[model samples]
Target: MLIENMKMAFSAIRINKMRSFLTMLGIIIGIGSVISIVSIGDTMRTMFADLYKEVGLTQAYISIGYWLDDVRQSDYFTLDDLERVKEVFGDEIAYIDSQSYVSADALYGRAKVKFDFQGIDYNYQDVQPVNIIYGRYLNEGDVKGRRKNVVMDVKSALQLFGVENAVGRTFRTTIYGSTDEYTVVGVYKKDLSPFQAMMMGQSDGGSAFIPYTLLTWPNDYFYAMRVYAKDDVNLDDFFGRLKVFIGRLKMRDAEDYYMATAVEEMGMMDSMMGGLSAAVGGIAAISLLVGGIGIMNIMLVSVTERTREIGIRKSLGARTKDIMIQFLTESALLSACGGMIGILLGSGLVSAVGAVLGVTAVVRPSVVLLAVGFSALVGIFFGMYPASKAAKKDPIEALRYE
Candidate 1:
């Protein structure tokens, strides 16, 4: 009996195929937009997670300075401070590295490239490992010997020497207005993301790393200290201890110095992405309501057009429940068809967009099921009024009028 009702419902839809298709259009567009946004949101979350993993969430950065009206420059952290942090944290701390930067221009023959010069300790790689494609990274001997050796990222090497393999190549740069020559000991692969590249000042022209001892900056002041904690260490607890240590060392509050961890940074990005997805999804959901309204309007018109048919069926001993079921089936089929098409459209679009953005698009099975289920619910809710109206119609009056 249910199959027979569905057949009749399909027959009705087939009679006005164009109108039925137009009615399904709203649902198609609404479901497509919502699913696409959800897919993209999931991709962004995955991308951020991968980035955090690559950078190491166990790492933290500490910037030392004095703040009056604005931030005021002070002396850089000493090796003693690094030792003190290690002593305080003990086994919890894995490693500590410091880096400072200076603006310099590299000149190799006629090719000249301006870059942000970084002075880093040998342990810098332990905190933020760089892939050495062409030579070796800095070593303890290099720092102790105060060797005039430098490591350039691939981008910088190409800019300075017009080649990827730039090891042993000599480049002259003005350090605090004094001309100094340095040999490139290695060429490291450039950062993959724009954010990471910008953080290292590699996006603006290029950047190179040198031994901290070779830095001519005033009185050995460093820009920032990077601390890496053991895997078992809790970042929140570690940060609290660091804040206390900084306060005691500076003879002021811990808030005086800027301190941040990769975990905190990743958390912020997660929150931002989640909020964006919610806001976009909410906007897209509004279209579902509009689609529901369209379904209701079309169903009402269908009931009016089929009033004589409803009268005929009633006269032939058909119950009001039977009439309601038939119309409801039609409405559900229409919505379900739209939803299925929307899922295909949305998934295809997500894959295409993800390829362009270098993010892997993931459309969860649960999300697809939810979309289809919600569309069916919209059909039932909106179809109720029209179906009820048709079921309640007086057979004699409907036949007489039509």
Candidate 2:
């Protein structure tokens, strides 16, 4: 009986194909837009993960205290503190690396790189995910010897030297103090970062990497310390302990200087973004209600136009439930067809946008399935009133309409 009703539904749609298509337009647009917008979020997750991999770094780069505070009111960690941290938490944590940033932004001509020529210890590369594509990374011997070595990215090299092969070249940079010539030993390809204008907003993207003590004459004047933990929970706990350590060092309350954890911040960002996405999706989903209303509007009109036929069916002893089911089936089929088309169009739209934005298009199969299922539900929801009205129409009254 359902199959027979389906065939009749198709024929009815065929007879008024133009109106049926017009009625479906709202549903198609509403569903397609929701699917397409949400798909971008999926690609963003992949992009962030790949970025972490390319930085030649691990996920938890840890350092819980100030690099160096010039003022007598010292609220920072020192080499001794770093040593204490390593000695105490060495087994539980990952490698500890020292870091220093230039006091001012270094300008290689008009292009300014925000990252100071950072000073780092020997195991810096291992802790972080930086790749030395062209040249070698900084070594410990350079730090001990105070060698003036600089490593840079392809874009940074081009900005400063206007060429790709900047390795073995020398330039006088005012990085640490008195202008001194530092040899560019190796050039590297930088990891992808979303904050382009502030390239190293998350990191020092365009800036050069040098030995721990290479940037300055004495290594004691370092700016920041970076610690890369073994893994996720390891670093988290290390930071937890380090906060206690910093409190002791600060000679005051725990909040003297800000302590931040990337993992903590990132997780929070993910959770907040997840809520935001759901909220936006919920608002967008409301459009589906509008589309369903349109479907009901059209379906009710269809039933009214065929009122005489309905009366004839009732005269032939067709049960009210049977008539209601036929109309409901037609309404559902209309929405289902709209949903299928929306899925196709939404996928194409996401792919096209992804290409333009230089990101991958991620289509969730579940999203497709859910979209179609939701469309069927819309049919049932909005079709309720119209179906009931059609079922309640008296056969004698319906026949008089003709």
Candidate 3:
């Protein structure tokens, strides 16, 4: 009986192919928009997760700055402070390294570029390891010997020397007021997160890393310290101890300095992304309501046009419930077909956009199912009035109508 009802519903639709397509238009646009936004949001979330994973979430950062009356005071971390952190954490700490930045201008023959300079200890790579495409990274010998060796990011190397493989090449740069020459010993791949890019000023800016020992500035001062904890250590316990130790050393409140773990940062980002996705999806859903109304209006017109047909069916001993079911099935099939088309359209659009943005578009199976189910519900809700109207028509009255 159900199959027979579907066939009759489909036959009606086939008879008015153009009108049926026009009615389904609204559903197609509504579902397509929502699905496309969802796909893009999921892709962005995945990208952020991958970035956090690449830079270990177990790591923490301590910036050397203090606040007084809501005003921030720039300060620096001393070598003594680093030693105290090590002594306090002991076995709980895996490794610690300090880094500072300076602004300098690099000159290689006629080509010159200005960039932010970074000074790092030998153990810096142990905490934040980057891929080395050419030559070797900084080692204990370079730090102990106070060697003026540097490692440049691939983009920076290309900008400075017109080639990514600029290993063993020397460049002159002015540090403070004195001019010094440094040899590029390695080229490292660059992968900066949005926060890191903003902090570093430019995403593709020319920058180089050198051993802190080579800098003439007081060895006691550093801009920030990165601390990595052992895998088995309890991070909460470690952070609590660190706060107390820093408080005693600074002779002030532990909140004076900014201390945070990568995990905390990632959580904040996740919440923000989730809210954005929900907001976008909600806005797009408004179109579905409009689509439902369109379906209801068209179903009413169909009933009015087929009044004689309904009367004949009733006269032939057809039940009122049967008439209602046929109409309802037609409505559902109309909406379900639109939903299928929208899914295909949305997925294709997402893939095209993802290719342009260099990201892999992600569409979950659950999202697809939800979209189809919601569309079917819309059909039922709107189709109710029209179906009831067709079922209640008196056979004698409908048959007498033109």
**TM-score per candidate:** 0.89, 0.84, 0.88
- Residue-wise C-alpha lDDT for candidate 1, range 1-402, written one tens digit per residue: 989977887888788889888888888888888889999888878887877887788988887543545544453566667668878887887777674677878888998888787887787786678899998998889887878889988988888898999999999998866788999999998547643443333555768888876664455555567788889888898778887787687566677777888898989998999999899888878887888889999999999988998899999998999989988988887787778788898999999888877656889999899999988888888899999999999999877756
Off by over 4 Å in 1: 64-76, 99-103, 175-178, 190-204, 213-219
Per-residue lDDT of candidate 2, residues 137-227 (tens digit) = 7677776677888787777777667788888877666764567767887887755534322324545445777776654334353334566
RMSD to true structure for each model, in Å: 2.8, 4.0, 3.1
Task: Point out where model 2 deviates above 4 Å.
Answer: 49-73, 98-100, 103-116, 133-135, 190-206, 214-223
Q: What is the lDDT of residue 374 in candidate 2?
A: 88
Say which candidate scores most in TM-score. 1
Worst 10 residues of 1 by lDDT: 194-203
Residue pairs clashing, model 1: none
Residue 393 lDDT in candidate 2: 85
Q: For this target, which candidate reaches the highest lDDT against the unseen true structure? A: 1
Please report how far candidate 1 places residue 121 from its true position, in Å. Answer: 2.8
Local error of candidate 1 at 268, Å?
1.7
Residue 263 error for model 3, in Å? Answer: 1.6
Local error of candidate 2 at residue 100 (angstroms): 4.1
Find the 10 residues in a row with the least total lDDT in model 2: 56-65
